[model samples]
Target: MDCVDLTTVLAGITLRNPVVTCSGTYGFGEEYADYCPLEALGGITLKGITPLPRLGNSVPRLAETPAGLLNSVGLENPGLEDFLVSYLPKVRKMPTAVIANISGFSLEDYVQMARALQVDSGLAALEVNISCPNVKHGGMHFGTDPHSAEEVIAAVKAVTNLPTIAKLSPNVTDIVEMARAAQRGGADALSLINTLLGMRIDIEQQRPLLANTFGGLSGPAIRPVAVRMVWQVAEAVDLPIIGMGGITTWQDAVEFLLAGATAISIGTGNFVNPQAPLEIIQGIKGYCEKHGLTSVRNLVGLAHKG
Candidate 1:
């Protein structure tokens, strides 16, 4: 307990711990201050930012399955100006590294969002979400094409000098190719696997459960897939990997790190248990101490023997 260290890396950025609250789930960094010590966790990725304020989708945006959740959050956000003026200042006051997650409808849109965030005071980096299905364009629903993925990454990288991470979609047939394309376009790091495309049918209503016929599936159901994708991309790219999917416990976070992920993010789990991230951090520390592991670094990539 006294000698274990949980510090980890994400795109050359060293995190004090491997536990991060995924974007959207944690809201703005300030919202979780009461739930968890802002400085104790690795980092917080702010809700997806857009060029203009969004109202988001209509009613019935979220649905829960047996072991997963379906969502079409529509990337609703307060736009760049409001976030910088209102949110960034408060986030900067916290001791944790604050990451801004940006989404766009086109390459130009992504560029504008990136340019706006590059000058923000408290942000540590920008995570380009190309895998959001709730959007009309530019998200993974459009990023499945390798050319489009590369173009989007290149366009965004051209405008911002901040460390950029391209969040990859799990819906692609060849995840490694998309990861490689992102790197070729100058992605400083990569995060996988954003929810898989899926749908839920309401037998009583005789229609889709979510307002959007098809939503992204996230939670324990997708953990194995996310883990495998992270392993594959870790082997395929030179950049650091921010692994996430259905992680709800410290053991899950440990598995991600073992699979080559530099850091881990908890998404849907946050909705079920607000204290899940804090518990995970404690669990990792306990594991390291009991096993006599001095630093968490020795665990990364331990599962990829090849």
Candidate 2:
């Protein structure tokens, strides 16, 4: 309802709602424009972009698991230049905020992409994807180590004026340490539980299902892990969090908000149902109205109150 305030402020950038399309799943905002109104959702995170074009991982990049999917699609995208010239213009026209997702093999690579995007006035923020598992260097490596994570965050912050969000990896000894590192490095916000490292084996062929052997696992199966990590990170750091992983329905989104995410991102849910994001947005509004809550922000971290 228009009477209910669903607006959420994430690291100073205000979102009309809490539902955002996760990067790597929602191409650029244009591909899904025909499926749903781009402006209706809170924001859209562009697919990961690097300094140079990426071919991504080898074939057999996707496989299905019990309640999730395994993907090793690397950070496949046109280089930064192509995106700026071809895609950014179209994204600028969208009514919703456009969050650029950047990945790199080195600290320099992250810095380069950040510096290049500084001139784009239409961009809302930069999501530093440090948890990409398919890349050999500078992907999960930086995210798993606090020192490396801090270096990458600090470097990008120095070169760019946009609010920076450090996307953290679940494949770590202590998720809280990683969250603290990002905050210490001056990250404006954080996105937790990128994907759990997993794989499937073709018993008949006696070989790994994915050509990349190991892939990031996502879907309902990982929701519990995602919630736990979000709760832990919330307790450890003061920065706002964009919670994702296995968030398919409004109920799932509510679980994330209760766990402490200021906002939520829909990933594999997009593939299952293109309208999932919009539906979840409406569901949240309905829930707030029925519960007599004036603002959606009141639902955040409610589980931590006890």
Per-candidate local distance difference test: 0.86, 0.92
lDDT tens per residue, model 2, 1-306: 357899999989999999998999999888887787988999999999999998999989999998899999988899999998899888779899889999999999999999987636588999999899887876999999999999999999999999999999999999999999998899999988798999999999999999999999999889999999999999879999999999999999999999999999999988898999999999999989998888999999999997
* RMSD after CA superposition, every candidate: 1.5, 1.1
- Estimate the TM-score for candidate 1: 0.96
Model 2 is weakest, by summed lDDT over 10 consecutive residues, at: 115-124
User: Which parts of model 1 have CA positions greater than 4 angstroms off?
Assistant: none
RMSD of 2: 1.1
In terms of TM-score, the best-performing candidate is: 2
TM-score of each: 0.96, 0.98
lDDT value for candidate 2? 0.92
